[model samples]
Target: MIRPKLELADIFRAHGPAWRQANAGHVSLGQLKVMSAIEACRTETLGGHVAGCASCGHHHIAYNSCKNRHCPKCQGPAARDWMAARAEDLLPVEYFHVVVTLPAEIAQVAFWNKKAVYDLLFRASAETVMTIAADPRRMGAQVGMTSVLHTWGSALTHHPHIHMIVPGGGLSPDGTRWVPCRPGFFLHVRVLSRLFRRLFIEGLLALHRAGALSFFGDLAGLAEAGAFAAWLAPLRKSEWVVYAKPPFGGPEAVLAYLSRYTHRVAISNSRLVSADDATVAFRWKDYRIKRGDRQRIMRLATGEFIRRFLLHVLPDGFHRIRHYGLLASAGRKANIGKIRALLGQSPAIAPPEAGAEPVPLTLREPCPCCGGPMRVIEIFRRGQKPQSRAPPRDQAA
Candidate 1:
């Protein structure tokens, strides 16, 4: 496969030092660590291995990956492992894709109080969905959903939203049978939007009153109770975004969607066009424009680009992906079994091959010359050179 002309590492390598020096006080320790990790990823600084094909004697060197969750190069294998684990949880039912977005007012507050606001976003959205679905007038069933948080827009701007993959139906309240939603719809978006807005604001206020939320910069004045209430007043009446996309064709489509979103970074290497001493250029979509016009190029000075990228480095230990209701960790196994039984589907089984140890998932490249599997015969530590090995007799002089 051909390598792209530019990558996130390229931008970081070119301007990371200067950016760190210039904004030493402004950048967080996590952001700085991310920069260093990206810069060193898959490079000589981290050490690697040399793989050679026994059949064709074709040799190649493979560098080590940083395995940082935020690295684009490292997401592939991580996503695969995650999807594999989630495969058993899939129900043979139509799946709906829903997105819940925080309004600009809350987004600004979230920018300063990321951990708190993001937690609220997840809790409020999950509560909104399960609440609406449980209502007798609505679906009247217990639904399971996997929600993933995305905090950046196409241009790497701070835009926090939750993407949820929901089965089109759920278990009946009595847990005796499957309850299917309307053939073409999941729930009323208007109702969800209103309830989501109310829940989120209420949660935010509760956090503030408990002194869990912090305000800084321009928002410092909002620390006052009256001022915070006033700031939230307009938001209560403002429309929030909560929309469900058309149902995915089947389980396959849901898995495909999850593969892309479950481990995505702010920007992918493919979207990167070029990186130079002063500026970095990348592709971005302006959704407000027509479809054709939406795909456009955006260029930012290297430092600014780094800054924008760092804006998405989540608070340490924060979970960006979450499960709710029936999928909640505590009782997911039992809930899934009940759901499968109610749907009249047998439990999924993993096939085993006699005398075969399971092949661990990886993203390493195959042998180029013979198109065979490649394995590391030896490992080298950082700053150490790989030991030279003699070529096969066929190539010996």
Candidate 2:
């Protein structure tokens, strides 16, 4: 694939220094590190390697990727590898897409207490599904789900939400059989919404009572228990958005959907239209519109653009992707084996032992010059130049 003329790296290199200076102490260490990593990615600063095609005289120099989870240019390969690793886990059943969003009031608090609140969001959303699905009136089964957290909207705004992919069916409560949903339905959004709101509110209040939340500026009044509870009372009256789309075809389709949601950063390089000293422009979807064209271009002052991008810098060591229910890491393989059996399929393969060596994933991208294999011939450290003088290749990014 040809590279986009504009990139987050280009924007960072051009304006990051000035923006960093202007914001000084306001930036968190996590955001600063992300900026530094993106600025140095794919350049000589991080070093690289030389790959040569033995069948032909072609050679190329490929720079090392920072492999930062938040890097726009880096997520492609990351997503591919993760998909590969998860390929074996897919079941031959339809999958439903569910989204649960935090209301604006709670989102504001989440911004300040990211780790605490985001953790609660994951637990609450997961429990809401497990609880609702286990009811005899509902599916009455132990379903599995994969949840991905997205903290930014299309315009790089702070809109925190969870995207979940669930199998259209689940194992019976007694683990005796498979239970499938109606062909065109999953769960009632209204029921899910009410339960999610209640669980999340209860969890948030627990955190607050445990002195886990922080408040500042206009929200300082929330430091008091009475004020905080009263503030949340209004949210109880309002409806939170919970949407569940019809089930996708099957596991492969679910994999395709996950490729987009799982490893995504706030914005990708392709979305960048242009960046200059004064302004940066990019494409964003206007979701508020229900008809006609929803695509729109948004331009922000360079400083503001950088600020908005940094707004999504997740806390260090925080996980953005998680599995729950039958997908829980502990007994995933065994659970899948049982579910597959109930579906009249062969038993799933077992994973390797604790200290077993992993099989390498081999994806051969033929040489651009000739349809021949390309193999790494040389490795170099950061700030060092490769011995062979081959032109840089897009294979690296």
Clashes of 1: 0
In lDDT terms, which candidate is top? Answer: 2
| Residue 26 lDDT (model 2) | 95
True-vs-predicted CA distance for residue 213, candidate 1, Å: 1.7
Worst 10 residues of 1 by lDDT: 388-397
> Which tens-of-lDDT digit does each residue in 1-397 have in candidate 1?
4455678988888788988999989999999889999999887689887666556766656668899889998898899989988999999888999999998888999998999999999999999999999999999999989999999999999999999999888888888888999997999999999999999988998999999888888899999999999989998888899899999988898899999999999999999998888888899998998556688899999888999999999988999999998899998989989888877899888645565653442225665566666656667789976784633212321
Best by TM-score: 2
Residue 339's lDDT in candidate 1: 84
Estimate TM-scores for all models: 0.94, 0.96
Over 4 Å off, model 2: 348-363, 395-397
TM-score of candidate 1 relative to the true fold: 0.94
Give the poorly placed runs of model 1, Cα more than 4 Å off.
Answer: 351-365, 389-397
Clash pairs detected, candidate 2: none
In angstroms, the error of model 1 at 31 is 0.6
| Every candidate's lDDT | 0.87, 0.90
